[model samples]
Target: MKISNRSTSTGRRRTSAAVALGAVLALTATACGDDGSGGGEGAEGSGKGKIVFWDNNGGVRTDIWKEIIADFEKANPDIDVQYVGIASTEYQSKVDTAIQGGGLPDVGGVGAAMLAGFAAQNALEPLDGRLAKSSLNGKLNKDMIESLKAAGGGDDKLYSIPTSANNGVLYYRTDLFKKAGLAEPTTWENFYKAAEKLTDKSKNAFGYTIRGGAGSIAQALDAMYGQSGITSFWDSSGEKTTVNDPKNVAALEKYAGLYKKVTPAADLNNDFTKMVAQWDSGTIGMLNHNLGSYQDHVKALGVDKFRGVPQPTGPGGRRVQVSNPVDGLGLFKSSKNKEAAWKFIEFALSHEVNSRFNESAGQVPANLEAAKDPWIEKAEPTKLAARALSDGSTSIVQLPYYLPDWNTISKADNEPNFQKVLLGKLSAKDFLDKMAEQLNEAQKEWKQQNG
Candidate 1:
């Protein structure tokens, strides 16, 4: 989720390791030829041939990529997929280096956060026309596609095809809620009331855990907008943010106030992992996390003890939540095997294939048919999230992913300020205002450049 910059040496080291460790499908030059099956644009080696792919987020994702690549090759024996696994810390720099020195892979991870940089550098191949003619045209999730398009530097061209989305869930302890004679935490009012009533300082029990450390910004934004019923990230002019609106400031006031009173004191520095640990080990009332940890909670507490649900509704009974960063694949403009690369992308996103990938990744598959696989219906959070997203019960507030500096502003510039807000060292309004200034400036810069 956090793809950061790195030194040239570190990037080269990681890139070499990627090639050496997992380029199993590397094809000989004789395997390269145009077969015209993918109906793509490009030069001679454009069809049923071989293409190299770089996994932008390696380490955790390498094994799954290997499986996907193998399956893709089995389906299309003529198309060979060479997998390069680059750790996330070095991914961006490695790609940048490739762009400068002339070695961009045929395809690679173009996740929403990194899409802007790739598009900005003109490194991505536009896939709008190609996709419309392919089998995947109408089968992909519309929202996920829009998120990718917005991230593609505002050019309205499809550069990356989304594979899956991670949605946030409000996890509540059913056992604790039942014992306390409280209703399900379906609304913000009920959530706060339960949090206050469930705390027992003498016994080391608490109602909630706050992620005041790394990756705090996304959760906070969801809470603010979900409570305020704000659906749009931008205002009417489309050149500014609605994050620091007065209504959101009021919402943040109440959300941040729960830090010390009902949450553990250690929450002042807890990140998602630590916050989830506290929720799993303690008698906390609720946790705001994505589906990635559902298995952990199930293992620790058993399935009957907890349940994952969409975020509680706001005053208007509307469910508005921020979209977790979506991961997608992009074809490089420099790919000599464009048609083959496109076939690999299409093959990977096919119903059964995409299901396999998202199953291992623990995410909601972007392919509509793949989303309906029996496994998603059985997974705790993924089931509810996939259903809600597909049925239109939940509305998503897309972040300004087109802003190239968004990650820096959210993680580096504001994480400390957010912790201050939780610790009472700063007011909620001031914190939101600081974020608003940075966001508005970034928006202006983006519009100027794109226009």
Candidate 2:
């Protein structure tokens, strides 16, 4: 369920490597078409007559995507569907190379985090008009559709169609909460109290598991917004970063202080996988992760032992949580077989097919009807997420998705600085200041280049 491009634990090891890759990507930006035009010379019009589709997460969703492709081909006997599954870790790099080298796929999976970058390069074919004429226009989730539009630079144009959405949830042990005479962690006040009460250093038990390694920034940002009540990653005008705002700094300090006392020392180096494994096998009280890890928790601890709930609300009695990175499919402008490729996308997003895919992936489907499947109805996490979204008290803190350098800043550059905050080597203010400095520079540069 993890999109390799968004999650750090997927194999992004060194910051130096990421910096090097960022440099290469920056240099190749012009190669991806800077004038909002289609791709390279030969990239125009998919003349091959074959639909070359790329599945972002090769091994994880290869079989399911292949099955969907098979169904699409069965429905259209004349169109040859070429399926190429690439691991999440390698997908972005490959796509960047293709955009520069003139071998882009006709259609491929694109996550919210990567949408702006691709759109900035003009590699994506705008889908708003196409979707309006398609059957999926009104059947898709409105929030996700809006989220995708925002991710594509807040334009009316749609660069991608949402396939599914993920959200942050706190999974807690029912038995442990009962034993401690504690209620569910619904508010930050109660959540922190529960963590403190559940931790027993002598017993090698902690309250929470911290993901200080790869992909830690997003979790930290969620905690900050949850406590600080901030609604957006950037301030009004989208030019200034509010990461180092006083309230955010206070919220971040409180979140990071839970490290040694409530979280284990080993958590300092733990990625999402390691953190989840520790929480599942050990005596942790609360684990914060996205819905993608729900199946893993169910497998490790029976469904009866634990429960997943939306993020705890802030002091204002409002739930301020950042939306987990939404994944979707984007059409390549260079493809000659655009119409045929659109047909396959339409087929894959049909209610039944979307239901089958989301069911296997254990995520909330983007198709409104597909979300009503029996599997989602029976899943507690999905039910809670649905309620949270519909309750009218939750606010999503949308990040600055329009910035092409967003992925680099949030993933690679911000991680080590966050780790410093956890290790107490850097203050929360300093961390946020550094992050804000980088983001502001990136934002300014993006405007100069893009506008």
Candidate 3:
């Protein structure tokens, strides 16, 4: 998925706008209290009550959470559920208001990028101790769990468990490649040549496309960083940013080189939406996008017409995918219903619920058992993704607090400067120096406000 700098809107919070489609449970503050009846920390000492849930209204995977809510209510009749779906774009501001007034939901879903920022502000409750005793915790993907732990930082505490996610991979047109006498590229050099050969003026086609937009560049940077085999962006333990290092410079330079050939000059304006349009029009041979695009393309082009492969190797010969378990359900720090919330989490990740969700929604299942799920095995893209996750070819990076601004800087600063290098306006070394300067300044300013 693209790393967006814009705040999450309420509508984007839940990909689906559908209501619970179940009974509307009454809202009562007494429901989520920390009573002795297995209700949790900071909850009121009440025995029986309802749990209020706030979900993203228009996410691509909205129905999964809806179904989970229905199933949870059916299983636990004593617990009442009050559901409110929020749009993603307005979610952060809505949440900010709620947080300031101490009126958060009992349980809610959050984007992975914002998880750390919340934890840092003491807006999230640590789930490590509670989750450790659950039978389902061990069945989650280790890399996903590690990503969450890394995002939490300091104590390796888990603030939330991933429910679903998206990842980036190279989408190629096999038919075009065959006609052009090319194989799916395994390295950057070959990929460039393939793009040139694929680009036919008469055919109105190009080799590949990328989101030159900030979100796209950040995703590309994550992909490039992974291929460079550098694990951490900044070592909080060490207290320094390695963005100015020679290795990073080399990676940036390599990207600048490739930007000259395959990618369109209008990349600065391109985002996932525009890139996908090019792919749909058959005007681009390859593009980088998330799992949703994988499913969407397969549906549009036919299962055998397209395929997803690991991103090509960089100059350093490393492979990586920019992805993480981003969708998750978490209880608010101000929540009163601990038991109700945990019950929702458990039911959401249960074998049956997870499988049903993955089957219809076309996502890689968060539950490990869901990996072997029949829906995954039956679908071409899901099958490929399942194998990729199992083999550890994916890189799920922890987004830092200043992600919004970081995304902007990567685009507003590095992209134009790098584009200058591609257009022969500057040398790679000059581009790298300018990029490092901007990134360093961004890092410094971010620390001042968030750290």
TM-score for candidate 2, residues paired by index: 0.83
Q: Write the per-residue lDDT of candidate 2 for residues 371-413, one digit (tens) a residue.
A: 8888997778888898898889899887777666677678766
- Runs in model 2 deviating more than 4 A are 1-50, 76-90, 201-203, 236-238, 446-451
lDDT to native, each model: 0.79, 0.79, 0.61
Shift in Å, residue 47, candidate 1: 7.0
Which candidate do you rate higher for TM-score, 1 or 3? 1
When summed lDDT is taken over every stretch of 10 residues in candidate 1, the lowest stretch is: 23-32
RMSD of each: 7.5, 6.1, 8.4
In model 1, the runs with Cα more than 4 Å from the true position are: 1-63, 73-106, 201-203, 265-274, 334-341, 386-393
**Backbone clashes under 3 angstroms, per model:** 1, 3, 38
In candidate 1, position 274 carries an lDDT of: 80
Q: How much is 397 displaced in model 3, in angstroms?
A: 7.4
Q: Give the per-residue lDDT digits (tens) of candidate 3, residues 197-305.
A: 8876565677877566435555556645655666566656434555555776677566655563666667656666666776876667887776666666866787776
Q: Alpha carbon lDDT of residue 371, candidate 1? A: 82
Query: Whose TM-score is greatest here?
Result: 2
